[model samples]
Target: MFQTSSALIRNVHSQVADRVGTSIVRGDIGVGETLPSEMQICQMMDVSRTVVREAIRTLTGKGLVESRPKSGTRVRPPQQWNQLDPDVLRWRLETSDMDSYLAKLFQLRCAVEPAAAALAAISAGQDDLTLIRTAYEGMAAAKVNEKFVAADIAFHQAIYFATRNEFFWPIAQMFDVTLRQSFTIAARGSHRARALVEHNAVLEAIATRNAEGAREATNVLLKNSADDLVRIRGREFASRPKA
Candidate 1:
Protein backbone atom coordinates (compact mmCIF):
# COMPACT_ATOMS: atom_id res chain seq x y z
CA MET A 1 0.00 0.00 0.00
CA PHE A 2 2.76 2.43 0.96
CA GLN A 3 4.77 1.67 -2.16
CA THR A 4 1.76 2.11 -4.41
CA SER A 5 0.90 5.46 -2.83
CA SER A 6 4.51 6.62 -3.18
CA ALA A 7 4.48 5.61 -6.83
CA LEU A 8 1.28 7.57 -7.43
CA ILE A 9 2.78 10.66 -5.85
CA ARG A 10 5.86 10.37 -8.04
CA ASN A 11 3.66 10.07 -11.11
CA VAL A 12 1.78 13.24 -10.16
CA HIS A 13 5.04 15.08 -9.57
CA SER A 14 6.28 14.07 -13.01
CA GLN A 15 3.02 15.12 -14.60
CA VAL A 16 3.30 18.58 -13.06
CA ALA A 17 6.91 18.84 -14.12
CA ASP A 18 6.07 17.88 -17.69
CA ARG A 19 3.26 20.42 -17.89
CA VAL A 20 5.51 23.24 -16.64
CA GLY A 21 8.46 22.10 -18.68
CA THR A 22 6.42 21.95 -21.89
CA SER A 23 5.11 25.47 -21.29
CA ILE A 24 8.62 26.81 -20.79
CA VAL A 25 10.04 25.01 -23.78
CA ARG A 26 7.19 26.10 -26.04
CA GLY A 27 7.77 29.73 -24.96
CA ASP A 28 4.28 29.85 -23.50
CA ILE A 29 6.20 30.72 -20.36
CA GLY A 30 8.96 32.93 -21.69
CA VAL A 31 12.57 32.57 -20.62
CA GLY A 32 13.50 34.58 -17.52
CA GLU A 33 9.81 34.86 -16.61
CA THR A 34 9.02 33.78 -13.09
CA LEU A 35 6.70 30.86 -12.56
CA PRO A 36 3.51 31.26 -10.59
CA SER A 37 3.73 31.15 -6.81
CA GLU A 38 3.74 27.73 -5.18
CA MET A 39 0.32 28.34 -3.61
CA GLN A 40 -1.02 29.49 -6.97
CA ILE A 41 0.35 26.38 -8.69
CA CYS A 42 -1.02 24.10 -6.01
CA GLN A 43 -4.46 25.66 -6.34
CA MET A 44 -4.37 25.81 -10.13
CA MET A 45 -3.06 22.30 -10.64
CA ASP A 46 -5.16 20.97 -7.71
CA VAL A 47 -2.11 19.22 -6.33
CA SER A 48 -0.33 19.53 -3.02
CA ARG A 49 2.43 22.11 -2.43
CA THR A 50 4.89 19.24 -2.05
CA VAL A 51 4.12 18.00 -5.56
CA VAL A 52 4.69 21.48 -7.01
CA ARG A 53 7.99 21.83 -5.17
CA GLU A 54 9.15 18.44 -6.32
CA ALA A 55 8.18 19.27 -9.88
CA ILE A 56 10.12 22.53 -9.75
CA ARG A 57 13.13 20.65 -8.42
CA THR A 58 12.84 18.24 -11.32
CA LEU A 59 12.87 21.15 -13.78
CA THR A 60 15.84 22.70 -11.96
CA GLY A 61 17.79 19.45 -12.29
CA LYS A 62 17.07 19.52 -16.03
CA GLY A 63 18.46 23.11 -16.13
CA LEU A 64 15.07 24.39 -17.21
CA VAL A 65 14.52 26.73 -14.32
CA GLU A 66 16.20 28.18 -11.21
CA SER A 67 14.82 29.37 -7.89
CA ARG A 68 16.45 31.70 -5.35
CA PRO A 69 15.59 32.68 -1.81
CA LYS A 70 13.76 35.89 -2.65
CA SER A 71 13.30 35.59 -6.41
CA GLY A 72 10.77 33.04 -7.62
CA THR A 73 11.57 30.26 -10.07
CA ARG A 74 12.34 31.55 -13.57
CA VAL A 75 12.90 29.78 -16.89
CA ARG A 76 16.50 29.57 -18.05
CA PRO A 77 17.85 30.60 -21.42
CA PRO A 78 18.26 27.98 -24.17
CA GLN A 79 22.07 28.14 -23.91
CA GLN A 80 21.85 27.02 -20.28
CA TRP A 81 19.56 24.04 -21.03
CA ASN A 82 20.82 20.46 -20.92
CA GLN A 83 19.86 19.77 -24.52
CA LEU A 84 20.98 16.14 -24.56
CA ASP A 85 18.81 15.26 -21.55
CA PRO A 86 16.02 13.10 -23.02
CA ASP A 87 13.12 15.06 -21.56
CA VAL A 88 14.64 18.33 -22.72
CA LEU A 89 15.29 16.89 -26.16
CA ARG A 90 11.66 15.77 -26.41
CA TRP A 91 10.43 19.19 -25.38
CA ARG A 92 12.69 20.93 -27.90
CA LEU A 93 11.43 18.74 -30.70
CA GLU A 94 7.84 19.35 -29.67
CA THR A 95 8.35 23.12 -29.95
CA SER A 96 10.88 23.55 -32.75
CA ASP A 97 10.12 24.02 -36.44
CA MET A 98 10.65 20.72 -38.24
CA ASP A 99 13.31 21.90 -40.69
CA SER A 100 15.46 23.54 -38.03
CA TYR A 101 15.16 20.56 -35.74
CA LEU A 102 16.09 18.13 -38.54
CA ALA A 103 19.12 20.25 -39.46
CA LYS A 104 20.51 20.26 -35.92
CA LEU A 105 19.70 16.58 -35.37
CA PHE A 106 21.48 15.57 -38.58
CA GLN A 107 24.48 17.75 -37.71
CA LEU A 108 24.86 15.98 -34.38
CA ARG A 109 24.37 12.55 -35.99
CA CYS A 110 26.92 13.33 -38.72
CA ALA A 111 29.51 14.21 -36.10
CA VAL A 112 28.94 11.17 -33.85
CA GLU A 113 27.63 8.18 -35.82
CA PRO A 114 30.43 7.81 -38.43
CA ALA A 115 33.11 7.78 -35.75
CA ALA A 116 31.12 5.29 -33.73
CA ALA A 117 30.73 3.10 -36.81
CA ALA A 118 34.50 3.19 -37.43
CA LEU A 119 35.15 2.21 -33.81
CA ALA A 120 32.62 -0.61 -34.09
CA ALA A 121 34.41 -1.90 -37.20
CA ILE A 122 37.64 -2.01 -35.22
CA SER A 123 36.35 -3.26 -31.83
CA ALA A 124 33.26 -5.38 -32.44
CA GLY A 125 33.38 -9.02 -31.36
CA GLN A 126 31.32 -11.94 -32.69
CA ASP A 127 28.46 -11.21 -30.32
CA ASP A 128 28.40 -7.54 -31.31
CA LEU A 129 28.34 -8.49 -34.96
CA THR A 130 25.50 -10.90 -34.32
CA LEU A 131 23.47 -8.25 -32.49
CA ILE A 132 23.95 -5.74 -35.33
CA ARG A 133 23.18 -8.33 -37.96
CA THR A 134 20.01 -9.34 -36.15
CA ALA A 135 18.90 -5.69 -36.00
CA TYR A 136 19.67 -5.26 -39.73
CA GLU A 137 17.69 -8.38 -40.53
CA GLY A 138 14.82 -7.04 -38.49
CA MET A 139 14.90 -3.84 -40.57
CA ALA A 140 15.02 -5.79 -43.80
CA ALA A 141 12.09 -7.97 -42.86
CA ALA A 142 9.85 -5.25 -41.37
CA LYS A 143 6.63 -4.97 -43.42
CA VAL A 144 5.25 -1.97 -41.52
CA ASN A 145 6.47 1.48 -40.48
CA GLU A 146 6.39 0.80 -36.74
CA LYS A 147 8.53 -2.31 -36.96
CA PHE A 148 10.95 -0.67 -39.37
CA VAL A 149 11.49 2.32 -37.05
CA ALA A 150 12.14 0.06 -34.07
CA ALA A 151 14.63 -2.05 -36.04
CA ASP A 152 16.40 1.05 -37.37
CA ILE A 153 16.85 2.37 -33.81
CA ALA A 154 18.07 -1.05 -32.69
CA PHE A 155 20.53 -1.21 -35.58
CA HIS A 156 22.18 2.12 -34.63
CA GLN A 157 22.06 1.23 -30.95
CA ALA A 158 23.86 -2.04 -31.64
CA ILE A 159 26.63 -0.20 -33.49
CA TYR A 160 27.17 2.09 -30.50
CA PHE A 161 27.34 -0.93 -28.22
CA ALA A 162 29.83 -2.57 -30.62
CA THR A 163 32.14 0.44 -30.30
CA ARG A 164 33.10 -0.83 -26.80
CA ASN A 165 33.20 2.82 -25.75
CA GLU A 166 31.24 3.61 -22.58
CA PHE A 167 30.80 7.30 -23.45
CA PHE A 168 29.31 6.55 -26.85
CA TRP A 169 26.61 4.31 -25.34
CA PRO A 170 25.03 7.12 -23.33
CA ILE A 171 25.26 9.44 -26.36
CA ALA A 172 23.42 6.92 -28.49
CA GLN A 173 20.78 6.35 -25.83
CA MET A 174 20.20 10.09 -25.65
CA PHE A 175 19.18 10.01 -29.29
CA ASP A 176 16.41 7.41 -28.90
CA VAL A 177 13.43 9.73 -29.37
CA THR A 178 15.05 11.76 -32.15
CA LEU A 179 16.06 8.62 -33.99
CA ARG A 180 12.48 7.33 -34.02
CA GLN A 181 11.23 10.65 -35.39
CA SER A 182 13.91 10.92 -38.08
CA PHE A 183 13.72 7.28 -39.12
CA THR A 184 9.95 7.56 -39.54
CA ILE A 185 10.44 10.59 -41.78
CA ALA A 186 13.27 9.06 -43.81
CA ALA A 187 11.49 5.75 -44.33
CA ARG A 188 8.56 7.29 -46.19
CA GLY A 189 7.81 6.30 -49.87
CA SER A 190 10.49 4.47 -51.94
CA HIS A 191 13.30 5.81 -49.77
CA ARG A 192 13.16 2.65 -47.62
CA ALA A 193 14.65 0.55 -50.41
CA ARG A 194 17.64 2.90 -50.84
CA ALA A 195 18.07 3.11 -47.05
CA LEU A 196 18.22 -0.66 -46.72
CA VAL A 197 21.00 -0.79 -49.30
CA GLU A 198 22.93 1.94 -47.49
CA HIS A 199 22.43 0.10 -44.20
CA ASN A 200 23.76 -3.08 -45.86
CA ALA A 201 26.86 -1.22 -46.91
CA VAL A 202 27.40 -0.18 -43.30
CA LEU A 203 26.82 -3.71 -42.05
CA GLU A 204 29.12 -5.19 -44.66
CA ALA A 205 31.95 -2.77 -43.84
CA ILE A 206 31.66 -3.44 -40.12
CA ALA A 207 31.44 -7.18 -40.71
CA THR A 208 34.60 -7.03 -42.82
CA ARG A 209 36.45 -5.03 -40.11
CA ASN A 210 36.98 -2.14 -42.51
CA ALA A 211 37.11 1.00 -40.36
CA GLU A 212 37.48 3.49 -43.21
CA GLY A 213 34.83 1.71 -45.21
CA ALA A 214 32.46 1.77 -42.26
CA ARG A 215 33.04 5.51 -41.78
CA GLU A 216 32.53 6.23 -45.46
CA ALA A 217 29.40 4.09 -45.61
CA THR A 218 27.89 5.72 -42.52
CA ASN A 219 28.56 9.16 -44.05
CA VAL A 220 26.86 8.13 -47.27
CA LEU A 221 23.87 6.83 -45.34
CA LEU A 222 23.48 10.04 -43.34
CA LYS A 223 23.88 12.22 -46.46
CA ASN A 224 21.16 10.31 -48.26
CA SER A 225 18.83 10.58 -45.25
CA ALA A 226 19.45 14.33 -45.09
CA ASP A 227 18.72 14.68 -48.78
CA ASP A 228 15.47 12.77 -48.36
CA LEU A 229 14.47 15.04 -45.48
CA VAL A 230 15.12 18.14 -47.59
CA ARG A 231 13.03 16.83 -50.42
CA ILE A 232 10.18 15.96 -48.07
CA ARG A 233 10.34 19.41 -46.51
CA GLY A 234 10.25 20.96 -49.95
CA ARG A 235 7.14 19.01 -50.88
CA GLU A 236 5.41 20.06 -47.68
CA PHE A 237 6.32 23.72 -48.27
CA ALA A 238 4.99 23.55 -51.80
CA SER A 239 1.74 21.99 -50.67
CA ARG A 240 1.06 24.60 -47.98
CA PRO A 241 -1.55 27.29 -48.81
CA LYS A 242 -0.19 30.77 -49.50
CA ALA A 243 -0.62 33.38 -46.80
Candidate 2:
Protein backbone atom coordinates (compact mmCIF):
# COMPACT_ATOMS: atom_id res chain seq x y z
CA MET A 1 0.00 0.00 0.00
CA PHE A 2 2.78 2.43 0.85
CA GLN A 3 4.70 1.62 -2.37
CA THR A 4 1.59 1.98 -4.48
CA SER A 5 0.75 5.39 -2.97
CA SER A 6 4.32 6.56 -3.50
CA ALA A 7 4.14 5.50 -7.14
CA LEU A 8 0.91 7.42 -7.59
CA ILE A 9 2.50 10.56 -6.16
CA ARG A 10 5.45 10.19 -8.50
CA ASN A 11 3.13 9.90 -11.44
CA VAL A 12 1.32 13.07 -10.47
CA HIS A 13 4.63 14.87 -10.03
CA SER A 14 5.71 13.85 -13.53
CA GLN A 15 2.37 14.88 -15.04
CA VAL A 16 2.67 18.34 -13.49
CA ALA A 17 6.25 18.77 -14.68
CA ASP A 18 5.41 17.69 -18.22
CA ARG A 19 2.43 20.02 -18.42
CA VAL A 20 4.42 23.03 -17.21
CA GLY A 21 7.46 22.15 -19.26
CA THR A 22 5.47 21.77 -22.44
CA SER A 23 3.76 25.08 -21.80
CA ILE A 24 7.07 26.88 -21.30
CA VAL A 25 8.60 25.34 -24.40
CA ARG A 26 5.61 26.15 -26.58
CA GLY A 27 5.88 29.82 -25.55
CA ASP A 28 2.50 29.75 -23.89
CA ILE A 29 4.38 30.78 -20.78
CA GLY A 30 6.77 33.28 -22.34
CA VAL A 31 10.36 33.77 -21.28
CA GLY A 32 10.80 35.93 -18.19
CA GLU A 33 7.16 35.41 -17.35
CA THR A 34 6.61 34.24 -13.82
CA LEU A 35 4.76 31.01 -13.25
CA PRO A 36 1.69 30.71 -11.10
CA SER A 37 2.31 30.72 -7.36
CA GLU A 38 2.94 27.39 -5.67
CA MET A 39 -0.30 27.56 -3.74
CA GLN A 40 -2.10 28.62 -6.93
CA ILE A 41 -0.64 25.72 -8.85
CA CYS A 42 -1.58 23.29 -6.09
CA GLN A 43 -5.15 24.48 -6.27
CA MET A 44 -5.26 24.50 -10.09
CA MET A 45 -3.64 21.10 -10.52
CA ASP A 46 -5.50 19.59 -7.58
CA VAL A 47 -2.24 18.36 -6.10
CA SER A 48 -0.46 19.06 -2.82
CA ARG A 49 2.04 21.88 -2.43
CA THR A 50 4.80 19.29 -2.24
CA VAL A 51 3.98 18.01 -5.70
CA VAL A 52 4.01 21.49 -7.19
CA ARG A 53 7.34 22.24 -5.56
CA GLU A 54 8.81 19.01 -6.88
CA ALA A 55 7.51 19.78 -10.35
CA ILE A 56 9.11 23.23 -10.23
CA ARG A 57 12.38 21.69 -9.17
CA THR A 58 12.20 19.31 -12.10
CA LEU A 59 11.74 22.16 -14.58
CA THR A 60 14.47 24.18 -12.93
CA GLY A 61 16.90 21.29 -13.34
CA LYS A 62 16.14 21.30 -17.05
CA GLY A 63 16.98 25.06 -17.13
CA LEU A 64 13.42 25.97 -17.92
CA VAL A 65 12.73 28.14 -14.88
CA GLU A 66 14.44 29.95 -12.00
CA SER A 67 12.99 30.79 -8.63
CA ARG A 68 13.87 33.73 -6.43
CA PRO A 69 13.22 34.25 -2.72
CA LYS A 70 10.58 36.90 -3.20
CA SER A 71 9.90 37.30 -6.94
CA GLY A 72 8.69 33.75 -7.62
CA THR A 73 9.62 31.41 -10.52
CA ARG A 74 10.15 32.77 -14.01
CA VAL A 75 10.76 31.01 -17.28
CA ARG A 76 14.27 31.33 -18.61
CA PRO A 77 15.27 32.40 -22.07
CA PRO A 78 15.78 29.78 -24.80
CA GLN A 79 19.55 30.28 -24.64
CA GLN A 80 19.49 28.99 -21.07
CA TRP A 81 17.71 25.76 -21.96
CA ASN A 82 19.42 22.38 -21.76
CA GLN A 83 18.84 21.43 -25.37
CA LEU A 84 20.32 17.96 -24.93
CA ASP A 85 17.78 17.00 -22.30
CA PRO A 86 15.47 14.39 -23.79
CA ASP A 87 12.27 16.14 -22.70
CA VAL A 88 13.50 19.51 -23.92
CA LEU A 89 14.52 18.03 -27.27
CA ARG A 90 11.15 16.33 -27.66
CA TRP A 91 9.21 19.48 -26.77
CA ARG A 92 11.22 21.64 -29.17
CA LEU A 93 10.76 19.18 -32.00
CA GLU A 94 7.05 19.01 -31.30
CA THR A 95 6.52 22.79 -31.25
CA SER A 96 9.15 24.46 -33.43
CA ASP A 97 9.19 24.81 -37.21
CA MET A 98 10.49 21.48 -38.51
CA ASP A 99 12.48 22.81 -41.49
CA SER A 100 14.45 25.31 -39.45
CA TYR A 101 15.03 22.87 -36.60
CA LEU A 102 16.29 20.08 -38.90
CA ALA A 103 18.56 22.41 -40.84
CA LYS A 104 20.28 23.61 -37.69
CA LEU A 105 20.51 20.07 -36.30
CA PHE A 106 22.17 18.80 -39.49
CA GLN A 107 24.54 21.77 -39.47
CA LEU A 108 25.71 20.79 -35.99
CA ARG A 109 26.13 17.18 -37.12
CA CYS A 110 28.13 18.21 -40.19
CA ALA A 111 30.54 20.23 -38.12
CA VAL A 112 31.13 17.66 -35.38
CA GLU A 113 30.82 14.23 -37.01
CA PRO A 114 33.68 14.56 -39.48
CA ALA A 115 36.13 15.72 -36.82
CA ALA A 116 35.05 12.85 -34.57
CA ALA A 117 35.52 10.42 -37.44
CA ALA A 118 39.06 11.73 -38.03
CA LEU A 119 39.92 11.32 -34.38
CA ALA A 120 38.49 7.81 -34.37
CA ALA A 121 40.69 6.90 -37.31
CA ILE A 122 43.75 8.00 -35.35
CA SER A 123 42.85 6.58 -31.93
CA ALA A 124 40.68 3.49 -32.38
CA GLY A 125 42.01 0.28 -30.77
CA GLN A 126 41.43 -3.27 -32.00
CA ASP A 127 38.34 -3.65 -29.85
CA ASP A 128 36.96 -0.33 -31.07
CA LEU A 129 37.35 -1.45 -34.66
CA THR A 130 35.63 -4.72 -33.96
CA LEU A 131 32.66 -3.01 -32.34
CA ILE A 132 32.28 -0.60 -35.23
CA ARG A 133 32.58 -3.42 -37.75
CA THR A 134 29.99 -5.47 -35.91
CA ALA A 135 27.60 -2.55 -35.92
CA TYR A 136 28.14 -2.07 -39.65
CA GLU A 137 27.43 -5.76 -40.30
CA GLY A 138 24.23 -5.44 -38.30
CA MET A 139 23.22 -2.47 -40.40
CA ALA A 140 23.94 -4.36 -43.58
CA ALA A 141 21.82 -7.27 -42.48
CA ALA A 142 18.86 -5.27 -41.13
CA LYS A 143 15.65 -6.15 -42.99
CA VAL A 144 13.39 -3.63 -41.29
CA ASN A 145 13.44 -0.02 -40.07
CA GLU A 146 13.57 -0.84 -36.36
CA LYS A 147 16.63 -3.06 -36.71
CA PHE A 148 18.33 -0.65 -39.10
CA VAL A 149 17.91 2.35 -36.78
CA ALA A 150 19.25 0.47 -33.79
CA ALA A 151 22.35 -0.67 -35.69
CA ASP A 152 22.81 2.72 -37.26
CA ILE A 153 22.88 4.41 -33.84
CA ALA A 154 25.28 1.81 -32.54
CA PHE A 155 27.54 2.30 -35.57
CA HIS A 156 27.94 6.06 -35.00
CA GLN A 157 28.11 5.70 -31.25
CA ALA A 158 30.95 3.17 -31.62
CA ILE A 159 32.90 5.67 -33.70
CA TYR A 160 32.49 8.34 -31.04
CA PHE A 161 33.71 5.92 -28.37
CA ALA A 162 36.59 4.92 -30.62
CA THR A 163 37.77 8.55 -30.63
CA ARG A 164 38.71 8.03 -26.97
CA ASN A 165 37.74 11.62 -26.18
CA GLU A 166 35.65 12.17 -23.07
CA PHE A 167 33.95 15.23 -24.52
CA PHE A 168 32.83 13.32 -27.61
CA TRP A 169 31.02 10.67 -25.59
CA PRO A 170 28.14 12.93 -24.49
CA ILE A 171 27.66 13.92 -28.13
CA ALA A 172 27.20 10.28 -29.01
CA GLN A 173 24.59 9.99 -26.28
CA MET A 174 22.85 13.18 -27.38
CA PHE A 175 22.22 11.89 -30.88
CA ASP A 176 20.04 8.97 -29.80
CA VAL A 177 16.55 10.47 -30.22
CA THR A 178 17.45 12.96 -32.94
CA LEU A 179 19.17 10.32 -35.05
CA ARG A 180 16.21 8.00 -34.72
CA GLN A 181 13.92 10.72 -36.09
CA SER A 182 16.35 11.79 -38.82
CA PHE A 183 17.05 8.23 -39.97
CA THR A 184 13.35 7.45 -40.14
CA ILE A 185 12.82 10.39 -42.46
CA ALA A 186 15.93 9.72 -44.54
CA ALA A 187 15.07 6.06 -44.98
CA ARG A 188 11.67 6.79 -46.41
CA GLY A 189 11.07 5.63 -50.03
CA SER A 190 14.09 3.87 -51.65
CA HIS A 191 17.13 5.56 -50.08
CA ARG A 192 18.33 2.80 -47.74
CA ALA A 193 20.61 1.09 -50.33
CA ARG A 194 22.49 4.30 -51.11
CA ALA A 195 22.72 5.12 -47.40
CA LEU A 196 24.31 1.75 -46.72
CA VAL A 197 27.00 2.39 -49.34
CA GLU A 198 27.73 5.80 -47.86
CA HIS A 199 27.99 4.32 -44.36
CA ASN A 200 30.36 1.63 -45.69
CA ALA A 201 32.63 4.31 -47.13
CA VAL A 202 33.04 5.89 -43.71
CA LEU A 203 33.59 2.52 -42.04
CA GLU A 204 36.24 1.53 -44.58
CA ALA A 205 38.12 4.79 -44.21
CA ILE A 206 38.11 4.53 -40.41
CA ALA A 207 39.20 0.89 -40.43
CA THR A 208 42.18 1.75 -42.66
CA ARG A 209 43.32 4.39 -40.12
CA ASN A 210 43.16 7.03 -42.82
CA ALA A 211 42.27 10.16 -40.89
CA GLU A 212 41.79 12.50 -43.82
CA GLY A 213 39.94 9.86 -45.82
CA ALA A 214 37.65 9.22 -42.87
CA ARG A 215 36.93 12.92 -42.51
CA GLU A 216 36.10 13.26 -46.20
CA ALA A 217 33.97 10.13 -46.22
CA THR A 218 32.03 11.30 -43.15
CA ASN A 219 31.34 14.59 -44.91
CA VAL A 220 30.01 12.73 -47.92
CA LEU A 221 27.74 10.63 -45.72
CA LEU A 222 26.37 13.66 -43.90
CA LYS A 223 25.75 15.53 -47.14
CA ASN A 224 23.79 12.63 -48.52
CA SER A 225 21.74 12.52 -45.32
CA ALA A 226 20.92 16.20 -45.61
CA ASP A 227 20.00 15.74 -49.26
CA ASP A 228 17.74 12.85 -48.44
CA LEU A 229 15.93 14.96 -45.85
CA VAL A 230 15.51 17.77 -48.36
CA ARG A 231 14.06 15.46 -50.97
CA ILE A 232 11.71 13.91 -48.50
CA ARG A 233 10.60 17.29 -47.21
CA GLY A 234 9.91 18.42 -50.72
CA ARG A 235 7.81 15.38 -51.47
CA GLU A 236 5.87 15.94 -48.23
CA PHE A 237 5.19 19.56 -49.17
CA ALA A 238 4.10 18.62 -52.67
CA SER A 239 1.65 16.10 -51.34
CA ARG A 240 0.02 18.42 -48.80
CA PRO A 241 -3.55 19.56 -49.39
CA LYS A 242 -4.17 23.10 -50.63
CA ALA A 243 -7.09 25.11 -49.34
Candidate 2 at 233: error in angstroms? 1.4
After TM-score superposition, the amount by which residue 62's alpha carbon in candidate 1 deviates from its true location, in angstroms, is 0.8
Q: All candidates' TM-scores?
A: 0.88, 0.88
Model 1, position 45, has a per-residue lDDT of 83
Q: Write the per-residue lDDT of candidate 2 for residues 1-243, one digit (tens) a residue.
A: 001111124488887887788778878888999998998888778899999999999999999999999999999998998988877877777666676677777778888999999999999999999999999999899998888888999999999999999888877887776677777776675888888898888898999999999999999998888778878887543333322
Which residue pairs show collisions in model 1? none
Q: Name every residue pair that clashes in candidate 2.
A: none
Candidate 1 C-alpha lDDT tens digits along 1-243: 001111124488888887788788888888888999999988888899999999999999999999998999998998898877888877777777776777777777899999999999999999999999998999999999989989989999999999999988877787677677877877775788889999999999999999999999999999888778768667652233322
**Global Cα lDDT for candidate 1:** 0.85
Candidate 1 wrong stretches, greater than 4 Å: 1-10, 235-243
